[model samples]
Target: MGRWLVLGGTRFLSRAVAAEALARGHEVVCAARGESGAVPEGAALVVVDRDVPGGLDALRGERFDAVVDVARMSYAWVRDALDALAPTAAHWTFVSTVSVYADAAALGQGVDGPLVPRRESGDGATDPEVYGGLKVAGEQAVREAAGDRALVVRAGLICGPGDGSDRFGYWPARFARGGRAVVPDAADQPAQIVDVRDLAAWIVAAGERGLTGTFDASGPRTTLGAVLDEVAAAVGAADLERVPVAPDVLAAAGVGPWAGPSSLPLWLPASHVGIVARDTAPAAAAGLRCRPVADTARAALEHERALGLDRERRAGLSPAEESRLLTHP
Candidate 1:
């Protein structure tokens, strides 16, 4: 068994990572503010807020084989983490986002590309900024802080059990209810999403290999309609007809989904998004490849059910809606 430290251990993806590490026979330690609640059952907990004056020093005493930073965004946070961890950890995995890319709609964007630039002040850029310019800045900050030792992974929309906000899962529940597929023209546009479990596995593998540099970690690129079909098929439903509304019409209704806005027509807004390859070659070369989306989707649905996320939805649906949800059963 190896020793592993996970920062931001209470968040969605971080918790998944911690769970995976423990299952792999690793002694995992989680350090985060108790915001999302206590660390996973077996993980040793070190409650330290990132904003604290001596937060970096709090983790200085312990050593581990690797450290996964799952909640870092600011450059200052990156710098502080590396300074404390570089001395002890053999590998450093920093969870990043695809927003680092300048032009995602274009292709051939290998592991390395021109970033969208960083803002010293977090206020300058946010989740709603122009595309992912802010994430680009965060990636740069991590790169500068860890250099050769840093293993940066740029992930797409992450989804799975313990989903927290029930964003992507909203589609599956809605589809299962067998109502009009309230979709916009963007329904046929490009869409990309990564299962949290696959991402967790890949991170652990990358750490074991000591791989460095940035790499795209995402699922296969497909249209939003294709996503609906695949997920429905995964859940044993396949007779529902998906109807699309005019972009403006959808906009007027004001329903924005995780995949896109109500007006986004076809494949997840292909104009701004295009998921070709996961750019996983660097990470793949490090002995990690994303699991098949089919399997990921199936497991994600199972996990969601196990979490009882559909209880309220199940109760809310009428008998007719429930019958429509059952494509064949």
Candidate 2:
């Protein structure tokens, strides 16, 4: 194994990946603007403002065997990163999202079926609405820079320890609370979430395998309804109300987690199953193993509450509301 460098290493996914690398005895270098997340002990730092002049450029002299990029949501951001570290690493693993898939009113789309078009030009720059497109473009940038050496692992909602984003974490923690739970209209809807540790395992393995091309790193297919019940059961909670919210409500609510009352057809219908619509064929071929949703949920709640990860807090709902939700049957 060669020296490994992680961009945004102090963040959720990056830290997990860096930890795995450290455990493997690979020379690990963790870099971020500030000390945050779960930074592995004894890892070197490449501190620089992501927006400052030569901020990223400061690391030009440093070289690594591979780089795991968990940040850089925009194409320009990724471009600058590639430019700065182009000469420092051999294998580049760019963490992208499955949202790159074309808009599907209903989730059940396949990776090979039709790809979500990327906004290559126009006002597409740095727009949150264009996050998926931006990621798509960023993937292209890595391809251009590292060529066959780049591994673009497209992940779905990543959960597990240190999960900064509580999108999925909220479910388990809230479900355990046992209250009048307001869920999306379709509880049967499928939602995909990869455990942070599982994702880190694959990325490190990919580097060792020198795997290239795009691979989808996500957990096995599961539904929101099942996940909720498991979480509720885990904490010995009962009585649940299924409040349904509509997509229009989600839109009208002005964004944010609680705004929407419905799960949307994010994933529904027996044929296609639940909400996670992206294809993980590429990743499965490269070897990505996912544990059961029950295990994933259990660990998420335990870890977050015990560790109080910043990422999980980002999606945390009110404890009072949670208590109220559990009142439902």
Candidate 3:
């Protein structure tokens, strides 16, 4: 069995990776502040703050076959982790985002797509507009520290059970409610979403195989309408009414795209159509497999029900906003 070290393992993808590694009989250690949630049961938990003085001291002198970093956003964080664990870990896997690309809407853009310019300064709070650039900086840090031993996975929208983002999960949970759901007019627009489980499993497998280089980790290309259909089928919402509203109308009404409160999940502006239609052929050839959209939707619905579907969500349109859009559009 391989020895694995997982950074930021208390929630979402990091937690999933730790769980997958443990299930495969690997010796896993998760280092993070235990506030968000607990790590998977079997993995050893090491509580350490990565922001304070000697925060990474807990990882000093520890050796692992592979290290998967899921929460490094700043250049400093990546550099610090590399300094502490570079000599001990043989392989370093950095979980990056597709946001690093400057033009995801461009046709044929893959891992070689033009990346956003690196931030001028690594200090201060990361500007939301330059989030992608910051990620680029972090990627560079990993490559500089680990050299050819580094593996970068540029992930798209991550969904499925345990997703707190609510971007891809919104449709499934909305369909379960059985009512007139507000959907975008661009139904045929392609969309890409990777299940958290699938992404975690692939990362673990790749690390074990000592895979290097970068890969665009996303799911099979699908359309928003097709995804909604799958969600309806999964939830048995045969009579669900999909109110198709024009993209401009939604945008005029202040409905943001992709994620966050008061936004329509998986719906991007016209200019960013290429973001959802990203090419996943390379990642697929690299052993990145995605589960069916139906399975993802169903699992998300079940999770939402457990979490109380009526509760306020961090993403997706609120019931009142949906009502306004559906009734007035």
Highest-TM-score candidate: 3
Best by lDDT: 3
Point out the worst 10-residue segment of candidate 2 by lDDT. Answer: 258-267
lDDT of 1 by residue, 1-329 (tens): 78999987786788888888988888998988788867778998888877775686878856788889865356556667777776677778888777666665764466666666665445533353333554565566567666677787877777766565455665555555454555445546666677888788888777776788777887666667677667666663455556665555444444343433222222333345544433555555665555655665666566567766445431123334334433322
Candidate 1, lDDT over the whole model: 0.64
Candidate 3 clashes between residue pairs 3 or more apart in a chain or in different chains: none
Q: Which stretches of candidate 3 lie over 4 Å from their true place?
A: 120-129
**TM-score pick, better of 1 and 3:** 3
The models' CA-based lDDT, in order, is 0.64, 0.67, 0.85
Q: Which parts of model 2 have CA positions greater than 4 angstroms off? A: 106-108, 113-128, 238-275, 307-329
RMSD of 3: 1.7
Clashes of each: 12, 26, 0
> What is the Cα root-mean-square deviation between model 1 and the actual structure?
5.0
With candidate 2 superimposed using the best TM-score fit, by how many Å does residue 106's alpha carbon deviate from the native?
A: 5.3
Once fitted onto the true fold, the runs of candidate 1 whose alpha carbons sit more than 4 angstroms away are 124-127, 130-134, 186-188, 236-239, 257-267, 275-278, 298-329
Residue 212, model 1: lDDT of 84
TM-score of each: 0.81, 0.80, 0.96
